[model samples]
Target: MADLTGSDLTAAKAQDDVAAPPSAPRRGGAAGLVRWDTAVGALLAVLLLCSFGFVGDFGNTLNLSFLIGNTLPMAVIALPMTMLVAAGEIDLSVGSVAGLSGAVMGSLWNAGMAIETIIPLCLLLGLVCGLVNGLLVTRLGLPSLAVTIGTMAAYRGIAQIVLGANSVTDFPQQYLDFGSGRIPGTFLPYAAIPWAVLAVIAVLVLHATGVGRSLFAVGASAEAAWFAGIRVKRLRLSMFAATGVVSALTGVFWVLHYASARYDNATGLELSVIAAVLLGGVDFDGGKGTLGGAIGGVFLLGTLENTMSLVDVSAQSQTVVTGVLLVVSVLGPRAGRQLARTVARRRSAGSGSAPAATG
Candidate 1:
């Protein structure tokens, strides 16, 4: 056998590293799809049972429709938010973007443009807003958190200025029904159909495709992904833009659902989105979450809210509950990961010392 040189060993190690799959939680191919996120989803099911068992009228078709309908917008935004977080970025400006898009939509509709025209324009404006955030982050090399915070305020301020304490509530009834209406004989809202399609797409993109795998790489370590030939900056920019577009679309849906358009629409929604995403097991720091978990987080919060309202729990207490969940979501995974590493280190030490004793 030929002797292996140090350079050959180094090259072999590098190759092995390159060939290794991403260390993020897997959803397919022998991973069996059960994970921490699955546990959260199961919790959602438990909450539903409790609601049915205890809360009066909680299982009624009308209330269920309203509950799911109200949550549709947040659920829609959560899809793109998952991808962005997985790619190691965040868009705090989404709520503001949604508000601004709604404001623009109302203004244009009130100015006598066709709703069709107004909708497309509003979507384009959302793309522009997202692109601006992307440019500032990727081109200026700014931190996404700081950049998005600034844009969040800017977008909301612009929305306020554009609509200025006025609301447009004269939308057509057909459109309104589409936003908030339920399917015949069922609690499932019409909005759910679109959200379902989007969810499936998000799952495929995040779990079944090369782009999804690349996002895991980028989130785990951008520098390493870049060295491995991924276009980290471009990928992140695309994520921000997609977030903007989806958020704006949700804004349109919100106006229709409520049959009201106000600059303050979707106010404080970013917190809920973040809380649900993180609570579902997507790490706030990026690179370790699943779409299933994120979706479950959204439903868990929704179910909790429904149950509280049914049992006459005050909104103030509900807010506290949300805050606690948010805190726990971030801390829980981190604590678990730390404990896991500690156990692993101990096992390694024990194995090595056993060999020493045998020698």
Candidate 2:
């Protein structure tokens, strides 16, 4: 084993790569998922109960439907985003990808194309957008954070060029209903059905299958995962593509839900998705987090925001709250990881000083 000196977990990881790499975060990996997951889940439940009891109009079927409907787009994109983040990467341009999808949808609609024809093309466009980001990161070895930031701007710019300032609101009524309308005699939105189905698939992929385990391995230690034959690059690339498709799908839903398609549709939504996901206890550092936690975070924030709105809290204040939550999520995981590393190190030192068993 290599003698490790660094106190920083990432620095230690960087230093101890070759000679018996230390599993720096194996014991409580993924940012102390069990603790944070349970914490966030309980918090969400409390928020819902309190909101129902205290907030007027929040428990009503109409408001509940609106809340779920509005949240589905962010939640949909979050499914793939969680996988991507857990695999040690992120696409900050998801909101932009969604915007581009909406822009393209509007442009094609203006060109008298069939809505059915336009939807597939929009999805394909998102795929291409994601592939471009993937290729840039995988092939060029660029950081995903930086790459997505650049692409976020570029994608939004292209969306603006494609749709300008125009708002397309003439989409078919049925599609709009599917986007925002509640199910008959229930509060569930029609769009939630697809999101639920996708959520189940994501849960299976992230928690139940080998690929899910691979995602954690890759995020935990890309080099180790690669050495262990995880096909790291391909897995990350596919996750990005999946994120793109979902973002595009969210864009379509955004347009339909709001009864408008503009270049700026879903603008700044990446912040909300990421905030909700991290708040749900998915470690921002990768290799740690649960899909269920991410979903809980989504609803918690969603319900909080909706309740705030019903009570006339300003949008600016809401944004501030979101920003603050994002900061907390990032910090909470880092603090837990630091503590975990310290405990693991002490345990290792203790074991090293222990007497060997006599044969």
Candidate 3:
């Protein structure tokens, strides 16, 4: 009888141990589902509802075209920005780079340069700027934040020097029309097509490709990535170059849409771009984000701006709202993590005590 009782107790204890592991996993899965459902899902639903309400014409095809057209420039740059942030870096010089590239294109055009010539030169200039940034940060072992901040000021200054308080408005009529034109008879803006395509490409690169996986690995831990044979420096340079090229492209798009390129175009836009990146769910510290989240973030910020404009909000007030939103978005994740840890601890304690009580 004694031996039987001992065997029964041992078997029950083993069963409980086995059950604990699976239960812990289930709880973890449940917590993740709850977090996603509560945070991302709820935020997205609210944005959709608000967008439709505010832009009543959102249901119309033309309205969709307009939204896409207006949003594409930001989207283009934001895609690469997402990648950069995922790798735990920031590029404050993007807006300045865009401004400078636009100025370069505009200046070349005004000098009677062919569109083909101007385009390639502008792209090259962007590439060079990116290269410099990568060299300064990686090769020189400087903090990216400091280096980019300096470059941001210098690049904008260069743009000003290139344009010298003048604006270029003599772009080819074809280019201007391309910027403003919609797809024939559909409200779909032609400008948006490129952006949409790029977004899809970006999604594929980040989610489907080995390079994307490498980027995540690098962002999660650069030393680990290097140890694993990833070319960390090369990847960083490539990312910087990609960012520059996209920013330049965005500059061209801006010039085309507005029919002019001023040295000051997109000034202070880096903040807006970064905000969109963070709002999209990229961690500031790196290693976690999605392009879809960034897209949603773009819509959120764009809609907020549009709404505020409609309500006659001051620029200062708008800035304040943005600042507040950024703070909340960033801090929200941390708070959630801490809460989850606390709950986990409590559950663990409860489970440990359950056997004691039964005994």
The prediction achieving the highest TM-score against the true structure is 1
Q: What is the lDDT of residue 165 in candidate 1?
A: 93
TM-score of each: 0.90, 0.87, 0.86
Model 2, residue 192: distance off in Å is 0.5
Q: Which consecutive 10 residues in model 1 have the weakest lDDT in total?
A: 23-32
1-359 per-residue lDDT for model 1 (tens digits) = 13434544454445434433332223122222347788798889989988888887998999999899988888999999998888889999999999999999999888999998889899999999999999999999999999999999999999999999999999878888898888998999999999999999999999999899999999999999999999999998898899999999999999999888999999999999999999888977778889999999999998898789888999999999999999988876666555554444444444445444443
Count the clashes in each prediction.
0, 1, 0
Tens digit per residue, CA lDDT, model 2, 1-359: 13232234434343334212245444455555457877888888898898899998999999999899888888998899889889989899999999999999998998999999999999999999999999999999999999999999999999999999898999988888888788899999888888889999999999999999999999999999999999999998999999999999999999999999999999889989999999988877799889998998898889889988988999899989999998988897787668767666666554433322210
lDDT winner: 2
Q: What are the RMSD figures for all models against the true structure? A: 5.4, 5.5, 5.5
Instruction: Give Cα distance to truth, residue 24, candidate 2, Å.
Output: 12
The better candidate by lDDT, 1 or 2, is 2
- Rank the candidate models, highest TM-score first: 1, 2, 3
For model 3, residues 287-333, the per-residue Cα lDDT tens digits are 88888888778777776675565557787898998899888778766
